[model samples]
Target: MSISASPKSRLLITHVLDFNSIFLFKAQVSRQSLGVLRDMKAAIYPITRPTIGRKKIPFRPYNTFPSGLKAEVVTFDE
Candidate 1:
């Protein structure tokens, strides 16, 4: 499952959170997709924090998506 941001871009949902009637989902996307989401004012956040030994690595949300890859969405049953 995917949401089309444009004729050439798409967001693949990887995780889903359901709260009563509202749904929150996660996606691994490209910088282009990130920009699109930002333009749409979607709530964009880093999915994880990286740490090396005692130092916390800086988080860059755009790095989450691997290069040359697309994503898929997940559906759940109530």
Candidate 2:
């Protein structure tokens, strides 16, 4: 099977055969492939969940100024 030029980071056939969670291992995959063990569990390798930081980053104002006086622009990377 062949994959197109799409850059999705989901699992592909190659990843499923041998799973590795270490970022370095996953890096070897092409853009279209995903972490082999992402969906399944195995005895040799434990499935790990992404650790969510329960404590939020302390919010500090980057720059405080009069709202009206500042020229503002916003962009969403999403």
Candidate 3:
């Protein structure tokens, strides 16, 4: 299953909590689509860490792979 977000949705997802929602959404969709045995992918904008004061704290979850998935992040030439 391929997941995509619109520009408006992407804007809302920039927040830390909203970004975390993406993971939940992914997991739910994966479960529902399991019967089809389709590959799961999200076509969202590159995720940037939110800032606290002048420093950008890391979003550690972004560095790890999703559970039960053998996936990799691929970048394209811009």
- Which candidate number would show the highest TM-score if scored against the true structure? 2
Ranking by TM-score: 2, 1, 3
Q: Give the better candidate number (1 or 2) by lDDT.
A: 1
TM-score of each: 0.17, 0.18, 0.15
Sorted by lDDT (best first), the order is 1, 3, 2
TM-score (C-alpha, index-matched) for candidate 2: 0.18
How does residue 20 of candidate 3 score in lDDT?
A: 34
Per residue, candidate 3 scores C-alpha lDDT tens digits across 1-78 of 234421111111135564333321111122323423353352243333322112122334665534312232121111
Instruction: After superposing candidate 3 on the true structure, give the runs of residues whose Cα lies further than 4 Å from its correct spot.
Output: 1-17, 23-60, 66-78
Model 1 worst lDDT window (10 residues)? 50-59
Candidate 2: residue 5 Cα off by (Å): 25
Clashes of 2: 1
Q: Rate the local accuracy (lDDT) of all candidates.
A: 0.32, 0.26, 0.27
**Across residues 1-78, which tens digit of lDDT does each residue of candidate 2 receive?**
355332322221223444421111111233223343353434245433432211111112534422311222111111
Ranking 1 against 3 by lDDT, winner? 1
